[model samples]
Target: MSANGGDSKVAVLVDCDNATPEILEFALRVVPQFGRVVLRRGYGNHTTLANRWQEALVRLAFTPCLQYQYAAGKNTSDIALALDAMEALFDERADTFCLVTSDSDFAYLCRKLRERGATVHIVGEAKSPDALRNASDQFFEWVPPTVKATSEQIPALIQKAEGSKKDDAKAVAKHRPLFVVEAVKLLAAETVEGKVQLGPLGTYLRRTYPSFSPKIYGHSGLMAMLNTYDRLTVEQVVKGSWLVSLSEASGK
Candidate 1:
């Protein structure tokens, strides 16, 4: 009872086999944006949950739904998760459901939940299939934090890459996504001063491209990634608040 005026109930179900425990925090943050998360559950086999996810589950206060494998090559965890989601839907325990997985098998489950008048959100990796992403009402691409470069080191890294013909420069350009540049310009045009807030910019990018992530471009976060490009201008209007706009050269 602590989000969106404590009215909407959100259920977050994680498929541990498909996603890692490190993404738990990111997934939880996404829940509050929609509503108060009432149910937090993680479904996995004995080995999957016990070995890697035990600490995260306890820290996040998530109920562990363990599924034993009776036969080889069978994912019983998926069945258990789907059953619980249906139960929650029928029992009116939650109006919104967030499935944290990249598996396309849950596409059917997402559609079923939506058919029953429930909002379905997906928090998964860049590898999530189009079927699964499209099934959910909103899809958030979970970009695992980069281990190579810290956020503080990004500005220096950006400076080092400028006008270089080395392999490193090619590597950076290879991961640079064009969709981000396009989104900033498109979103900026709708505003009075051609500036877009960080929150809405991120939401629009995630909604339009389910796999969009700054980590893919070797940046720690969105701001670091935006700073890599010269065609975009990022400014801090308030503490922890950012405004992004297209540069004069790139704007229409």
Candidate 2:
């Protein structure tokens, strides 16, 4: 259970052959916003990817399920991952699932999981099939985190610090609470019948936009964050469940 009283538990499954390490890191960061990640597994040909993924897998504490490619062109890991996901779903280990893959083959799997009342989130690349991305409750495009500009990229930063102080403040000031509120308001188009469930909306915003942070805006959780926005309204239709609708944000 989270401090915010989140009851949902998430199972994170990664198809290592289909996504990069940076994306996997980003996925893990976003999953916590939805719920606790009870199980973490990465499927791939570990023997072949040892040099590239060993340190990362170990550092992230992800259990690597090795699936070797016996043939010239075959995705043995995909089958393994699908099987495990089905078993976990049937076992009711978690109500939320995150598939970190760009493979279209899992699109049908996403539909089946949703039919069983599980919220499926896909962390995929921009090139991932639209069907696969749309099949899930939420889709997140992986973006490599930006680092500080290097001396080679901006030589002037190292040479002159006097005038750069104002520029740095300007950059930092752009990430105000209003920016997140505006984003939430814009997402009204994505809602169903003009309503957005808090759980899924939180998952969508956090996964879709990695830079979004409730803490930065001085909120404890997604509901708390949305509570501050007058343009949105939140209601508890049932115990421990929330629904948000576009109020003045919709501009109706």
Candidate 3:
């Protein structure tokens, strides 16, 4: 997350034709890693398909954009999704984007967004096209559907684990903790032009490094851990979310 404490603004666009409704539920669980889903829109010809998604879509507050197929073999849903994505980008409504689909058509859209300096996350099934996966800043494959944990569970787990240390103090004492430094380096390497969303950095850091929790180091959150280091700088964008950057002088 950004050194400054704020949320990143994100737009979530769902391609219903190529994505399952259950995937939407899975994808939403991890979206907070980027920012808030300030704008949510989905495109598909709902008439041809019958599923529980119709009710779920409204319950989830998704703005469904109807795209009826023009002919027997034509695919209009992809076109609709592309148009909406371009409109969102041109309007500057979101700083990051989440594309929830497995179709390769969105591979071009992902590249276009990153070219324009927007972070893109792709969430789809494991068999998602490689081109789309490559275009995303990070990609996640959906697992079997499960009930989501309550918000309180995360903090409670952190609190309970504070007293435990997997490594001995002597082992840790020989080296200064470099979680923040390593996280920044990893993000820079993965991002274009040494920039990445603060949200994805946190996800990557946790997944790649063991014993890298901010709470374990006496900090309540990722931003707090980043603040402890002078080499990192954080900025607050529009929605009180943070964007983190490495200071040029620090040479990190």
Candidate 4:
């Protein structure tokens, strides 16, 4: 913990088998959402694959953990990832852990981290295993292939809600009153089995909705505004940061 009582160090463990290269890129871009991804590693059976990811791994500067098949039905990658996570924990090199994979095998690892007071954030496909999602302090679902960005600008949505134009009728009808709805939609879409990282959600909102200034809405920042919305749920994960979701609001 820092002087501010914040967990700023992070370790990102990627299961190359269960995660897409594109989602990995998107996930890394949002690392600052929680803190810094100080230790980055990718675990897979790289020796045999000889695929695109092998070359991609070198370019991305990820420490590769090459696992060999021990038996016909065994996957050593999951065990390797878990071992590394524990090593990072014991070494005291990270205060928070980011697990990027859809494997439920990591559920135990996430629970273990939380037990030791380390913040765990999970990122995976929309249909990721539920046990893994529930184990993390926060989790994010990778965007689905079906979700496409609309042509309408975010500013237009805000303006239509605040303006008195009849043309605003369609925009108003099509959009939610607050940016939180868009935020929630994004969360819902990316949530792997209904899990989303509050930290990354906040980061994504800021990047995608820059004009959503909390000052304009008479709040200090985005988190405050999110808390005020009855449609949103916020959980304090580690001091200043929160795990946000719409499940509570939707009564799921």
Pick the lDDT winner.
Answer: 1
Tell me the whole-model lDDT of each prediction, alpha carbons only. 0.81, 0.72, 0.70, 0.68
- Write out the backbone clash pairs for model 2: none
TM-score between candidate 1 and the true structure: 0.61
Task: Give the per-residue lDDT of model 3 (tens digit) for 13-88.
Answer: 9888887787787678767767777888878886623464576578788988787778997889888888778788
Residue by residue across 106-132, what tens digits does model 4's lDDT show? 898888888887888887775676677
- Each candidate's number of clashing pairs is 0, 0, 7, 4
Candidate 1 C-alpha error for residue 231, in Å: 18
TM agreement with the true structure for every prediction:
0.61, 0.59, 0.58, 0.59
lDDT of 2: 0.72
Scored by lDDT, model 3 comes in at 0.70
Q: What TM-score does candidate 2 get on C-alpha atoms?
A: 0.59
Pairs of colliding residues, candidate 1: none
Instruction: Order the candidate numbers by lDDT, best to worst.
Output: 1, 2, 3, 4
Candidate 4 residues lying further than 4 Å off, grouped into runs, are 1-7, 47-49, 144-146, 149-252
